[model samples]
Target chain A: MSSWEPDSDFVFHMPTKVLYGPGSHREIRAEMADLACDRAVIVTDRGLRENTDLPARIQKALGATCVGVFDDVEPDSRFEIVDAGAAFAAKLGADCLVSVGGGSSMDTTKAISIVMTNGGSIREHLAVHALTGPQTPHIAVPTTAGTGSEVTNVALIKDEAARTKFFVLDNQIFPRTAILDPTLTTGLPAGLTASTAMDAMTHAIEAITSICRNSMSESFAVQAIGMINGAIRRAVEAPEDILARGTLLSAATMAGAAFCNAMVGVVHAVAHALGGVCSVPHGIANSIMLPHAIHFNAVTDAEAYAPVVATLGIKASSPLAAAQMAAARLTELAASCGLQTKLSQVGVNRRQFQEIADKAMADGAVLNNCRPVAGPEEIVALLDAAF
Target chain B: MAVVFPTAEWVAEFKKQIDEKPDYKEGGKGWREGVIVLIINAKPQVGIDADFNIYLDLHEGQCREARVCSDEEVGDHPFVIRGEYDRWKLVVLDQLEPVKAMMQGKLKLTGDLPTIVRNIDGAKTLVKCATYVETVFIDE
Candidate 1:
């Protein structure tokens, strides 16, 4: 019964079969056998290779078909890598595209799943891109809670030509089910914890302010905001706090689900561009840029910001104070997590920003931002403000 | 304005306070090293010199070496929280608050992300087992 209509034409969809809570991967593997999957392509990263035993666990648990490993992934996954993974899936005759990491693996799997069924280079299907044809079943096993790729049809692939991040979003790519397991994230480092937590926060706030905002999205975003506001610091400070980690996992999953349906805006649009151009890490880029983006958008919805401030639990003597408080709090949270809240600190400069901005304006994400980005100029201005 | 605590005696006082807290000891059970906090004036909003760092170390269960940041001694902070001295102290002394400052940008931190979380978990407390002149944020 998960159905919602947008305007007069589009309808929103969420994954029907969801496996949530700790150690849910086992249950997900059980479903693979039920689906009669013989072999599956495991799309993952080099980091996961060392940190977890996902591939082996899958092989042991499901007794299903196992495609050869495709671990040629970077933190900011590239288009070429996804293209290679797709070919690998085809070579293995893999029926299902199984992802075993965060956005990097899940997004890569989505792109590859489409390319496996469609006969063309990824470049062919660029904007408003649809599979336009039948595709193999895709299953998402999210190791982290951010980017809600498991629940949405959005697949972000890095475009080398435009040097931008593009979402090949369509209903066909949504995974049949998503595995939300908190144990999967216990080993996450503090930097990743803080960075990804902020990434989820960005997703929630951006969705809350999106042009397409609605009741369902607001409900999810509000819950996400509260969970993060209460538990993120504890998760960042204590890796072993399963309760805190679980809360963050839920928060991230909720944020991901919210944005996947509602879409994201400038912060993500700009973050995606930075990832493609400079190869900056997605979570860190979001952590550093979210404040500036939020500040920039604040002027667009001053009254709306009041609810956000209340959600953040801020009380100021004045509006100016409130604004300044929001900015400072962003910096402090990032700093406490061993992150700096500035693009300047992360090696992004004015010259590079101009190029990134041009690409970001064209990115699909900006359309969802509360204040529409008019052109590269406004993008650069935001970058300047962040710096 | 000098550090709100001023007396420099507060440095030793923090060492004493840190040693006295069983929760701090339990929270930091696995944390074996120390960290230095760099409090730059940023702007001489309150008074005092423009820059200085506080060198605080957590060794096993004891708090050691609370000193002023000497000239030519920049920071190699394992974990760092940066801001105006007043705001920094407000957090350190458990006065400023957590969600309040994070939302306001009064407190900032940097260093290894993994270790940061580990330290907090080991310490089992927030504001990362102090290492500040005063306790900041309520105990979580």
Candidate 2:
């Protein structure tokens, strides 16, 4: 026998190191040393840095090698933030970038990392796998458990020109190390807690039911679904339950990883539209549209949703039942958390529904949904039903 | 005697409809299991105190086993629901009960989410099927 490896039919490629647990939120100097990151800059939003000494703490942990901080990242961040971040990093001669805070900050870091290496505007680097250039070491530290920003290879960058959100899907965006620390999320607002948790739940379910989902992705999605279902309620009701918060953080990161390898569906696309159009908060927008989107998708893609429903411990008979159960459960969870389910309730009108639908169709994420949803007619119908 | 064709009788008839309906049969092909439903008139707004447990299992697109049980003898199956009969009737009859209400536990839900989602259309089919054979005050 030659003791050689045989040709395989399947392979899973995941390179990020996930360090989780209580207070694993320290500076990544030790990890940076491993990744050969000597000059590092922490990318964060002003809100996170507001009257907080956390950045100093990171500097202390990282020692004298820590570069200057780029604190201009904003929620629903524009691509200019990416440019500014890269320019700042270049000025400081930073070799590594660490993101702290939620989706906005992490997305900024991913965007900056790409442009800094590729030498162009974010628009030029929009296509999937477009960045053939080498990427600098980027570590994502997600403060919230929602966007799953740390592990996803996709970065949602607001295209201010097109007036719609566009995502950059490239392997370069996936963080080298994702540090899941529940402590970092302790400062999150109650509303954000519910919204982000729901967003995480959406990611897991959408991934589980996505058209491109394979068995491995499904397994990860199921675990994430169960965890989010159990954890979101607790985190919403009682914000201090570190264990539950940690579980949600873990679920979000895992979902990001799972969906990064796979892809998300229409709910994300619709939510992104809300962001680009109305500026509804990302997580809240996703939470509002989730069940309706699930029900809509269920009519065409119920079989794909079975495992997700099963993971949530729903009792059902067929694929349609599984999808219904998931949708129904999401509604229940939403009500309990005081989250609104209707688009009308959220100040969106019928006209905007069609407008959002049009925008959603143009969204790149919607192209990856389990089934092809054509335009605003059905989406308008679904939105009306949700209302 | 065909079970007297009351609500219970309609339950059987409902099962028969699901078996006969081509769309339902096709949609429910992968569904082969039992569900126990707990119908409760918690608020009694309808002035009719109806509380009963319906044990049901669908075997190959047909509702094979069904029995209305006492509250004390709640059987083990994947589905259990507790809510006002008015809500259930509204859900079954009008088929237009607010979806958010049904999902948010305002109507009361407890069971396996996967099984429920997989059988949602089938569940709707079951409700419609039962209504077709019953003389209940259900209108289109």
Candidate 3:
């Protein structure tokens, strides 16, 4: 039986145009033109600027229209970096943005676009539905298979002073186009591939079990889960396999589309808190917490998770058993991928559990958890168990 | 006779229903937040010639007050939800979910989103209260 009732009402919307192929990144000019944007700025990081030729290739593809490159984005994109990037883009007379890296870079571009058009500090527009209409045109070329920031309407910006991250969600911030070029992700290291694929997997699972999930989001989540399950191992072990890489990239976008509408659950809430409190990498935190979160919500969401079990290729006696097995299988899969399976392995301490729990309680994602958490103590217990 | 929506009587009745519901009292226990002002945009075609502001003084699972307020009286409330008259009608009629409507840009919400999101059950209870009111559509 489906989680949604026959008479349940839902609203589904996906506005961004996605171009997926081996070398779709080269279509930057056409994508920009589709939005009637002329001057484009490439928003990325210094690592991609120094190590890879992807930025240059996109610049060349955009030719005269590509005004400049802003590579000031950090690993966890900060508010200051977005402000600086926005100023740089505005100075260059850039009318559009082409983000050319992972989640941080793409999210930076989204924030920069908001600041450029709205003409204020990124902090001013922190509320949901903050923007009245669209912001600057943005084309996201994701070099990592995680985050799926290209399709999501949210940008996670860290506040250095507060030592926590905050979400800026608005439909207008969704990238105008997502260029999923698998070749851009083929050179990722084994650990990154594993961690990022796990991130996508977590997104699919959480979307499936989120209280707000509808048929359309569930369909995408299921498809993404199946694809990631089939391709993640090959994509990680044989990093150069284009087919596996492409599958993971496509699945990540599908997962993004799913969770963007349905929203995620406690896994993301805890992961965001971990990223904020401990400086643990987002994907790594999600990879470590995915199975544990599943276990926590499984009792209440067994029916919703049963499909995830099948998608993960697990066989079980019943829905509840299937949910439990699904959690166990995720642990095994994370271990096989060489991902850190516990918070302790990632340098998180018992003392920090309280702070992490406090932050997680305040997270927007927690609202949609299949199981309602009474207080921070429950999260502390979950963290203790994961530890 | 059905109380005409946007009138002072409708707001009083809505508050009465909210106070009577045990679900609202229980579900809203966590909601110690400040007032929520609903701005119903004018639809002149439907005879609502000017914007209507309904101020809800809600705290700790109780409706302290529900009354009509002027623009100046809205005054620094923690949450403000603005939408077309028709959209608000759909929400009051339980045909549309408020959170989903906000997510879809059909309604504009200005507040700490996480707080509102966390108290979604409370919000739903408030909406249920609206449905209990015997309302007559102004357009009809």
Candidate 4:
């Protein structure tokens, strides 16, 4: 494990089979059939359920295969809700899960699957490798271009009582198949589209700079970054532009795959903490924190960010300068989509800074940060700068 | 006149330093848990056993108690962060980042990872407080 060598003794997990295209959503029934699953339970949010005819369309596609629709999933997946969803699935005799929405729906289905198979509360499976048992197979149909929960072996579940967010990390949790249909994301609002695409970009940038990055992860991350940089503007300007949506969808999945192996850095760390403490949305937090975390890492590991800068179309004489340019470009792109660039603008108070910094330090993302964090002062400084 | 490592005076000095740092007090304000730093391979220069533990009663931005825990008391803490003598020395000497060292498996952690993570800022502050202690290593 030399300093320069990309290869290391790493175990790469690629279990999700991706079905990508303009109309891949229709492949849901066939994928379920291939998995020997007939009774499919659709887990989604109330917003998606009312706004789109997607549920009806999916039910019609599944015909007799569709057994139930648990549309009670909240914005951030919660334990009680997921537990109820598992009960609904069990009552409906669902053989498999069809998650239809953004990260919330996908993560809800993952947690429900764990409960369905393992027969325990979401709390038992919060730590890494906590799920030694198998899970009910899940097919994720993402309706948004962010989260990348379909391919990643991680699930973010919040405890409503504690008002704190926790995660389930396991190799067995990746969806058996991911249906990446661009049509599902065409109806998303411009603000959401921008934030979501920025989320994918953050995933790529962080993965490339993660300490555990390998060649395979780097390849996926670089390609995802390029796709996102080239197409996000078009996707935001013209929501129905199929090509841009398709590219963004592909990029999100690619970033998901990349980060699953390479892990993510401080951007995700601070973002997760913000999401927990301030009630800031995940993509918005990622969007606001991306540039700050990038600049922070670039100061120490400039060479690691060279490919990231290249993907962002920034070329400079020095790696640090190039990285700075890449961060600036992201800020510009985020503003173009109507996303805010500061913490105070998003309702995070000055008093909460210390708590946010504390939570950020606790996040697993801090461990994978490309550069060593000096301590809480450095983290507070980063938060203050972002603020 | 440096305080020797693994001494009550050193622990007392470390506690004083922690109380003096505004950042630690602010960053660890939400934390209400006890942590034990267990060290193994006590150097021959220190007339201690092969293993000893430092108990830190950290709660709500204050170090309420700091003392050496007997072997029977090590498991009583809500959080226990363990490592060898060399790794502990490097961390206290500012030669290693405590969080990174734990993530890299240079230090071992037990008892509730998520809780420990939620207090990560405090943990780092604790380590920072350790480095601020002017101590003479037993090996040195």
Candidate 5:
């Protein structure tokens, strides 16, 4: 076992009320009433708005409280989109937001709420702990079973000007309620299902090994790891299986809660960089980098990965061996799910490695990494290996 | 003789120690953000009647200046961290982590939090430098 000591002091706070079931999303009107919000706007993407009937169903469920829908959110959430969303909601006199779809939609809604309440550009509120009070009431209805953005206090918004993604971490952005309805996630394609499930897996692993992790966060992370390990393959294979979908959704939320409090580590840092630099989808980038990050972190925090090995049902002779086996098991799992295993497969070449490394070195998530990163050279090395 | 906390001598010693530590130099490389002011709120019962503001002009892995200054003199810095005298004592004694203390509301920080968070190793190194100063707490 690792000789790491428990933190001297830590705080655990998860206030978002979660409602889960087959059609729990229909309760959004009641949630709006509870928050004392009258005019609600549905924040989503154009694809879902045009193609799926989910938005129409939500609008019907919300009844007269749904004033309008803002469906301009792009695949990678951007500052301009958040500003436009805020303008749309403000113009509609929306007192509450109901975000529908994946992480981008939820994160855009969070940024819109910030801009509406704080009365400033989204760029002004990009820093951590920037909010002084609670934002506009928000109810997050996650259509995907990954990202856990509904329950997290973080919002990853891209800056088109800088060609980089900035993290917004504030306690007030936690959605007033999170509606996890398996019916919403059952339509996800097999590829997205596998990638997002691996995203949750990465969050769980990074949370457990993060330097700031405490007993409570560790509990959540460990549970999430076990749940994702058991449900990922089944969910990917049987996309219409409600039970598997529900388990994965709940596990994603649990992982979200864990990483939000304890914070994520190197995998997230590197993945965020890749998402910004190369436009790799966040979940896919995380899927490609998770095993590499585990191996890199194991050099300094082998004992921390022992719990992960046990949770993955792998028997090992020692902590370091357990960590290595855990990394190998993750690679096998991703391959079994048909996730891309290399940066090269995702169009990231050696020429872009240095820039990604520099961004990763500056990312806030790097501070919580188990090993102290010396410089960009170390990150470049990891990129080369993963490439 | 041990240097008293919140004194000019202590700040000087901290600067000297930070400059000497190879770990801080290596960890703090490329930290060109700006000045950071640490304000220790006073407790009259502990013989501290006024808030103590320690100005640290940190740039590119070096402490260009370290001194005790008034609040009015600390103009336009990118970061300011304020906490109770007792809380800072615990931090200096290595009983509490600085980032955790900030998250828990024991310390109130004003500035770009991401910059501070991104360079946490440098912050920890600064705290380590403080510990090297043989401290005589005012209350004690």
Candidate 6:
């Protein structure tokens, strides 16, 4: 094989079976039958359960298969909740897990599967490839357009006692299936719609330029970026536009799949650190740091961003110029969507910058960055720039 | 080159550089973990007859100890990173990120992952300081 094919020797893992489009949630019955799962536990957050009809809709779709509902998952889901979710699922004898809502809900479901099967604190299972053995099957029904948690093998479950977010990455934890229904997202306000799409865009850009990127991952990232660029504005403006929301949903999933293989870079590292350390919403944190990270990577791997520049419709004469244009366009897009462009705008104090930088340097995503980071000092400088 | 990596002189140089470099000190001040053992696997062409361990006790921004020791001597180390000689060479020469190398499976990391993640700057600083050693590579 040609040297251009990095993935020829590499493994590409995409185990999550996706059922997308309008009303795909109805396919849960068939999926359950396919997985030979008789009982399912629906995982969701209280906010989504209270605010949306998603829980009732999911129950109606599941019919007799839905044996239980664990609606206690919080945003940035904690280990205790996952433990409790696992217990609840076990009590109900749930053979399958159904996640409804966004990243937190889906992640909670993933964590539950781990604890249910592994029988330990989630902390013990916090390293790369820490998990082994079969997991109770999971089906994700994403209610938001970001996180792509539906397709990824990463679960960022927070440990409340440690005051740190621990990520669990294992192919075993990937949901067996995902249901993407854009109608569930129409109720998402303009702000959330914008922030989520920005998050998806961050995933795409980071994946596209990630050092571990391959042809397949790049194709997914590029397509995701293009779709997000084309449909984000409409999704935010019209909120109820099924086509636009559908496009953003597809983009988010594609970006998720891309980053799952290619992995993300500094943007995710910083954003994840923000989520862990400061309780910042992942989407907002990603949107705030995305442009600065793009600029940082562009300084060294400017040519890597040609696809992003072209996808964003930025005209430029050189690689650096293209990178700059892409970054500028991203900033403009975020601003137009009323998302905060500065970290300071989102209540992250200057005092916490050093700690956040330290965490970012340690994040798994930092390893996948195209341009090798010197250490926390460089990250602190980046944080300061974003500030 | 000032020293050849995987040698006693290189470990000493690494400790000295960590002490002398203000950036390393500042970046690693929050790292309180102790005892990191670098297990370099055997490479026949490079004169490595057997796998050896480099023990480092990093305490709140200071390298309390840095030395080459036998595998049996790597006692009570909280973090132990094991990898092939070539991968270690790449890391010491600044061609690869230590964390990246671990993720790519070129390096095997065993320790408290959260604390390590929290102290990632220290990890990077440790690797970055090695790059400044002006070391000689056996392959080169």
Name the best candidate (by TM-score): 3
DockQ-based CAPRI category assigned to the predicted complex of candidate 6: incorrect
Better of 5 and 6 by lDDT: 5
lDDT of 1 at A124: 52
| Model 2 residue A47 CA deviation in Å | 0.7
Chain B TM-score of every predicted model: 0.65, 0.70, 0.96, 0.87, 0.94, 0.92
List the per-model TM-score of the A chain.
Answer: 0.91, 0.92, 0.98, 0.97, 0.98, 0.96
Question: Model 1: residues >4 Å from true position, as ranges?
Answer: A1-11, A34-36, A317-324, B1-140
Q: Which candidate should be chosen as best, given lDDT against the real structure?
A: 3
Model 6 agreement with the true structure over A65-112: per-residue lDDT tens digits: 999899999998887888889889999989999999989999888888
The residue-by-residue lDDT of candidate 5 on A1-387, one tens digit each, is: 222347435667799999999999888898889999999999999999898888888999999999999999997788989999999999999999999999999999999999999877898776555467989999999989889999998888998877788767778899999999999888888899999989999888888888877778788888999899999899999988999999999999999998888778888888999988998988989988888887888888788787688788888787778888888888899899988899999999999999898888778788888888888898998888888
On the 0 to 100 scale, the lDDT of residue A212 in model 6 is 78
RMSD per model, one decimal: 24.0, 21.5, 2.4, 7.7, 3.1, 5.9
Per-residue CA lDDT of model 4 for B11-68, tens digit only, reads 8898888899776797788787656555554555556555767878888889888887
* CAPRI-style docking class of model 5 based on DockQ: acceptable
- Please tell me the TM-score of chain A for candidate 6: 0.96
DockQ of 1: 0.01
TM-score of each: 0.68, 0.69, 0.93, 0.77, 0.89, 0.79
Model 1: iRMSD? 17.9
- Predicted candidate 2 versus true structure: per-residue lDDT over A36-65, tens digit per residue: 889999998887788556656666767866
Per-model DockQ: 0.01, 0.01, 0.52, 0.12, 0.30, 0.17
Best-matching candidate per DockQ:
3
Model 3 bad stretches (over 4 Å): A1-4, B15-33, B59-65, B71-78
Evaluated against the true structure, the overall lDDT of model 3 is 0.87
Query: What are the per-residue Cα lDDT tens digits for candidate 4 across A58-97?
Result: 7777888998899999978778998899999999989899
Model 4 segments beyond 4 Å from truth?
A: A1-4, B1-112, B116-140
- How big a share of the true inter-chain contacts is recovered in candidate 1? 0.00
Q: Lowest summed lDDT over 10 consecutive residues: which window, candidate 3 chain A?
A: A1-10
Give the per-residue Cα lDDT of candidate 6 at A261. Answer: 82
